[model samples]
Target: MFERFNLSEETLKALRKKGYRKPTPVQEKAVPLLLEGRDLVGQAQTGTGKTAAFGLPAVELVDPSRGEVQVLVLVPTRELAIQVAKEVGELGRERGVKVLALYGGKPVAGQVELLRRLRPQVVVGTPGRIRDLLERGVLDLSKVRFFVLDEADRMLDMGFIDDIEFIHSKTPPRKQTALFSATLPEEIRPVIKRFLRPDHGEVRIEPEKPTAEKVSQTVYRVREEELFDTFLRKLEETPFRKAIVFTQTKVEADELARRLRRAGFRAEAIHGDHSQTRRERVLRDFRRGRIDLLVATDVAARGLDISGVDAVFNYKLPLDAESYVHRIGRTGRAGREGVALSFSSDREDDRLQRVRKVAGDAFRFVNLSDRPVESGGRRPSSGGRFKKTFGGRKGKGTFGRRRSFGNPSGGG
Candidate 1:
């Protein structure tokens, strides 16, 4: 129980109000160390409760009476900045600990006004905006007691290493620090050495599968021209409350969302080209169930914490296995079963092989073209005959004996 951790009454009350009973593995290990004022590095997936693992302790450590920023959290994207701020704010609400979110694309003058008026104790922001504020002599980090870098790998991927270094240079040198990433690539090793203290703690939670276990994955082999038709057919056949369709480019995302809407589906596209206000509005609508389908590119959709996504569709395969895993990870969140469907052509066989290497036995292949559509209806029957294949040896082309498609696991 959280009470065992000796958390503040306010913090415990907040957790209980949020319906959090048991601690996740990352929370169980990291919270205690963080509460001890120890610098640490944590490795875990997106839905593993990393925010609470770090936010809870940070909230406890900050002094509300200081009336200055005592905690600083850096994230990769604007969406993440807003989300982390909301979560941390909720955790610190009862303690009268004010929180603020700063990011680019919003008016700087307004943020400056907020900084002066609110004087939040905790600030969560993107690197660029934080640097801008620091240079303008508004944001004061010298008194910050806790420093956090969430999704460190993504920050580096977006080429924010120099900005991160600049931001860190502004903060006090003796503060407690925490770095969290889903996967620690070789590129991030230097970052770990440069930022974290020599005696920092480390917590890593390894998953049995790279992707969520509750998500059923299927790859459909279709001709390039028939891909959209196949997608429409499969989408109609699948029962979903909400779904996200991923594309490799902004044009594709916009075009796909347009086509989907024309086909009478409630869909909207989000990408880098859209303004920040528009993106936020679209996301708000999606969360409120006004938009059932969200078409997004990988960059725009990173760090999204939306739950109740019943399915994810890869309109086109991502260039690498990591992107594929992240795309499918959007679904199967919060212990709910989800479906991920990918469309690939014979020309993209090599890309499929790379994904298979990481996905292992979870990769299931189905040739939907072989199945006959039902009369007077677009949906195909569950009893329809179709050829099924699973990942296996290079030449074998089969994992185990062929299995019937009628009873696929996780309802896919």
Candidate 2:
């Protein structure tokens, strides 16, 4: 399959070794342009093999003989940084191209020490850590030739535009740039406008959205102070209700999960605060049905391509209308109808109205909080005999081997 695309023989061998025969749509389109040195923006939904689309080109262009950093890749989270760096490193191993993933919450001393010796040719890191390293003179970006801002829109969504500029400032102007995003916001448009050469390419690969199909939208009204209590009572009487409660804040995620556990609901909290190892465990348990509720902030929710989410509860209002859509999308996946409930406490009436306005003609909403709560809720049925699929949630509970990336970039 790669023969038709004219990839370099060295890259072809690596792909074959990994059993990557045919390329995903994003890879097919983005690879040719990227290898040609066409600065571009790749628009594709998650899980469409996005990392490989850009990773191969980056690896091929790098010069391992000169150990100065040649490629700078920025991701939103440490997990993602590690994931990208690993993928890049794996493909570049034979060529002696080293990759390092630098992010917060991990030991900085080790990374500094590694750079002093190996001085990886490729550096993958989140915006904050990258900025920290640059400011502290630990990372050298002057010779960097390739720069990629992965999940650019998500960075904008998390308000990382300023940090991106700071990192970009450290790189030489002659560097080639590529950006990958699911959607373009006004904030991201300017990065292309200001940084990318005039005539940089754009490749949009649309992926199928099975998760959108299984979601059933609903609404509930309650008093502000009693809202959390009301959610606890609702699930008590509900059946077959394995759920993911989406909260806007990490604090709210921890607090709600704590309350749910206290109420006798088997629950766990997953968010950016948890280490990659902990997040992997949480995803495993949730998928295994050992945990009934998995409370998560938005960062915890994205990039989890698993299905069979029985319910997605918007325990609090989404910070924006689009996030609301992405939150409930976790359920109602894989062509199965799933429940999505949003709480509309009196204080959040205006926010609910905004949701309604944004959700017009999207999904029908039903009022359920008005119904009398059953004296006691029924136990939710388990997910049935575990089917061999993508395994478990990354931070929740999982079922099979979590994908492993041996390289520092974790690109694949």
Candidate 3:
């Protein structure tokens, strides 16, 4: 089936044995161009198996015989760094390839020790740790051939553009580069222009239709002062045992969790301020379906690939419109529909309008206050906390999306 795509014998065999019968649209379109060593900008929605699409090419291009680091992938979050590193390790398992993940919050000494001994063929890490290693001269980009900035938009959003540019300057100008993002904001265009090669190609995979049919979405138009009371009432109405509530500030995350638990709800807050171990413990209990609700800030919830989120609450709308899509996307997954409720006051109505514009046909809104006397109440499904993807494809849960540029520009 993949013959038309021209994968090598070893790769073809592995795909067949691994039960990868057909390539997703992303792999079909992107694999060919990247294999030719052309710099590429891939814009696609989440859950499209993009990791394999970009990962296979990197694996194929690596010279396992050479002990030096040949490829580098930069992500925005430590969670993403570990997730991507796990995928790279699985795909390169047969070849005995060494793939290492380096990020903050972990022991830096351990990562440095691993780097010195193995000198892995592929390195996956967040920008901060990679930048630190580069400054210490522990990481050498002089011999690097393949480079990818996965989640490029988020990297720029986190104010890592200067660091990315610095990292790019250290590499050979002629190296192969690929950038992946769900959406390429105007600000990010400059990053692409300054760093990539001359003849770059564009690949866009359109978003799949959203399935919220199994879920009943509702919006509450409460007064600013009554937000907390409305949240409690909705919790009583819905049968969701576990939920994720998004807030604007780290203080709000802490404050909301404290308030919820004080009101007799089992809840915890996760933010960047907490130690890495604390975050892990909180996330573990939530995933095990032990914790009833998780309160988080934007940075805490971004790129969280968790599944079976019964519902996602926009306790406060994020400033960015794209972030609204990301917040709701936490719940709906696989072929099963999930609930996404938002709390918008009179002052925040404009942002809600923006969300309606971008979401298009996949979303519908209802006034929660207009309920009938005999309301058909909703309850969480008895389904497992984890739901597999459509076509039974695993590890395809994406948190964001990027639209494509038809006539791409390379000018900085």
Steric clashes per prediction: 0, 38, 4
Clashing pairs in 3: 182-401, 182-402, 183-401, 183-402
Off by over 4 Å in 3: 93-97, 105-110, 156-163, 197-199, 222-229, 248-266, 271-275, 288-290, 297-302, 316-326, 332-337, 347-364, 368-412
CA lDDT, candidate 2, residue 329: 69
Query: Which 10-residue window in model 3 sums to the lowest lDDT?
Result: 396-405
lDDT of 3 by residue, 1-412 (tens): 6767666676677677678888899888898899988899998655687888888888888888888888899997788888998888777766666789989987888888999998899999888889888999888888889999998976775667878888888888778999998777798788888868768999987654334575545555556677788766566555454579999888899999998888777789987667667888999998886677899876567667687776788886666666676677777666555777777664565665565555544444433332221112332132422121222111122211111112323311
Residue pairs with colliding backbones in model 1 are none
lDDT of candidate 1 over 1-412, digit per residue (tens):
9899998999888888888999999999999999988899998877789999999998899999888999999997787898999999998888888999999989999999999999999999999899999999988999988999999977876678999999999999899999999778789999999989999999998644545378988888676678898777666666665789999888899999999888778889988677667888999999887887899987678767688888899987888777788888888877887889888764565666667667867857664444432233343244433225533113112211111124334653
lDDT tens readout by residue for model 2, 1-412: 8777676677778788888889888988998888888899988766778898888888888887898999989998887888888888887776677998998887888878888888888999989888888888988999989999998877776667889998999899897899998777676788989879888999986434324345556566566777876666555544333678888777888888887777767889987666667877888887776777889887667777555676778887675665676677677655566777677665555566556556654444333344322212421122312111221112122211222213323222
Please report the candidate that would top TM-score against the real structure. 3
TM-score of every prediction relative to native: 0.68, 0.68, 0.74
Q: Which number leads on lDDT?
A: 1
Model 2 lDDT vs. the true structure?
Answer: 0.74
- Cα RMSD to native, each candidate? 9.8, 10.8, 12.4
What C-alpha root-mean-square deviation, in Å, does candidate 2 show against the real structure?
10.8
Is candidate 1 or 3 superior in TM-score?
3
